[model samples]
Target chain A: MNVFKLNSWSPYVAGGMVGILICLSVLITGKYFGASTTFVRSAGLIEKVFAPERVEKMDYFVKKKVRIDWQWMFVVGVFFGSLLSSRISGDYRKTALPPMWETRFGPNRARRWVIAFVGGIIAMFGARMAGG
Target chain B: MNLLFWGLVTGIFFGFLLQKGQVLRYDKQLGALRLSDFTIVKFMLSTVIVAMVGIYFLHDFGLVALKPKTTALGANIIGGLIFGAGWGLLGYCPATAVGALGEGRWDSLFGIIGMLFGAAIYAEVYPALKTNVLAWGNLGKITLPGVLGINHWIVIVVLIIAFCSLFYWFEKKGV
Candidate 1:
């Protein structure tokens, strides 16, 4: 019972809960578990701020809209919760380039960002086109 | 606003579970790629199986509509390859990237930015994709039971058994 106070839960427990959440998500929203679309919505949100015309012109944006939704808030919550814990544990140092990325991609922040950006596009694009 | 309110509550719980699952840890994600850690696999597999059973049953009972996406083999293969390449380069999937950033790693911001740009591009090209890559294989909203022409419950039970066995092995191997 006190295990609820622990930093991490057993994978089974957490995973099971996520599964139940999936069911609830479908029941409540009529959608299964989705995360990729949030990025697209964010794109619309950002673009509308900069170029409202471009967002209006894009068919996908026109259909999906740019409002904050469940998954977006879910991601935000994930972030704030982590921020709170990391702050409490005093483990919140910022790294411009993680050494792991540097050892492979080299010490260039720009290059890393480029690859990451490309990766996000590829992943989301594939997920969309492939129906994954 | 009611739906949105529930959404906020759901997000808090969802985020809490993700954090507690420890799948947000950099080393755990890296290990998953390396095939050394089964934490992500365990978590995701469990999530999938449970969702499959729950959603399917709910749909069967007419409690919800099953909005299964079409099965486009060409799009799947090509898109998956492209996605894999990007994921390999980025070092974390989209969800984990957000979670990692929240954990104060901040290194995942690049992937998030990439997602924004990628999503923007995807929106513009989506209509064309319908006729091209997305049209390939065109199996209209078919499920495993639909393909095999059997009861979904049967398939679900078999999958659960299979997953449980895999879980047992992982535990024995001390993953």
Candidate 2:
């Protein structure tokens, strides 16, 4: 009956819920669930600000044809939805670093940010290379 | 029905599930990457099984079409390696990072920002990257059934059973 812990559900149940969501998505829209596409589109949108023609002619953007699409909105919804869930369950709390992170990586905020940024760059590079 | 509406609605449910499933938890994520925790893997395997079966059923009913992404051996292996490294380092994916941000883990923001910049970098040099890396071992759209030349149902059933057995074993091992 712990309000704070109520946010945590059995992995199986949560996984099932995700499955159901995916099922509904495909059943209704003929699209699979993905989030990386939003970042790509966001990047494309930003690129248009500086080099409009380059972005316009880029084969990647040409194929994707960037605008705020369902994926971007969907990702935004995920953020808000998570906030709502956490708020309702009393699990929402501001923390600069999770305990595990501090214990493993030490309490160096700058280092954490640098590693995360570099990792993200490498990861996204791979994602696009894989056409994700 | 507009697809955007569907995306918004489903995205909410998806976020809720990710939060509840503890996939947004840093410890759980790190453990999974380190092979010390099977919880996330079980969750992901269950999701794949469900989606595989459910999507096939929907397709059979003529309610949807299955458009599996193209499989490129080079792309998958290379991308998977980098993604795995990043996951091990940041302990978050694009989806789970959003969930964690909602839960108020500010550090997750760094990873998110990095992801955005990374995406920008990829977009900037996409033409060259596409030609050199993306074209490697390119295999047109494919699926398990197509690769194995078996019925989708058969693959689904087999994978379901296999995953269930693995799940049971993992639970017993308590890793």
Candidate 3:
């Protein structure tokens, strides 16, 4: 049997599969799915490791400081899942940057770096305001 | 063993699908924005329908606990708009960005990092905004079936028809 490559599935097909996966998640675990929480938790862990006082005082970080394993496992699963998908599809490429990005953003890499940092800040701010 | 675990698993699966759909590609996402490719719309529509149906059933059966009622209508709409803009700019949402990064696309790393930063900022500033910015409106859990006074099943059927018609129209338009 031929397995479908990462790019082989049509959008609808892949979406439906994802939808089913969502259903499975609900059935098996009974929770809504999200990604930002993992990152927030990781940030908490970083703070805990280097600056315990900061982690303890910050309301946002404090809540996530406990039970670090659960969030870490989930984050690890996501990272590995993506890696496995890429490997199986024969589409894995290891580089700090893509060629098109380098060409478009320029050789300094400063533009991309600055945009990413600002963008990350804005995204996290929005999530917290929304109570996520 | 509980809902949180399932949530994580579901997230990982969504990451996988994002990779499979090539949605992590900047070109594909940009193409969708241009209306040259209907992939994003199609995919989102299908997923929303599935989620809606699932939620409806779960509520109907008392299989899951619903969130306590909150009436932050202004926040929901504003947050949704901001999120949509971010999605367009980044070419990937929080979930897919992880998958993209997993595929070794450095740009996705930026996207994920951006999301984390955004969430953190929100947390720090939420108290100040909660009173003013979040108090613009208070429409609590408005649903089509509730507003229309129709049976849940009927509402679901109507939505299915409407979505299918939209899909057909888009297909006809050669998108």
The DockQ leader among the candidates is 2
TM-score of chain B of 3: 0.82
lDDT of 2 by residue, B71-96 (tens): 87787888888877876777788888
- Listed in order, each prediction's TM-score against the native is 0.87, 0.94, 0.82
How does model 2 score on DockQ? 0.71
TM-score (C-alpha, index-matched) for candidate 2: 0.94
Q: Candidate 1 residues B1-175, lDDT tens each?
A: 6666666566656666776787876567767788888898899999888888888889888998888777778888988887777777777777778777866667688788887788888888988886887778777778898899999899999999999999999999998
DockQ of 3: 0.46
Q: Name the top lDDT candidate.
A: 2
Better of 1 and 2 by DockQ: 2
Q: Which one wins on TM-score?
A: 2
The predicted structure with the larger TM-score, 1 or 3, is 1
lDDT of 3 by residue, B1-175 (tens): 4544644565566667767776766556666777787877778777767866887787788876544335576776677666656666566666666776788877778777777667656646655776787787877766667778988779887887898798898889978
Model 1 misplaced stretches (Cα beyond 4 Å):
A81-114
Q: What's the lDDT for residue A40 in model 1?
A: 81
Order the candidates by TM-score, highest first — what do you get?
2, 1, 3
Judge candidate 3 at residue B80 and give its lDDT.
Answer: 66
Ranking by DockQ: 2, 1, 3
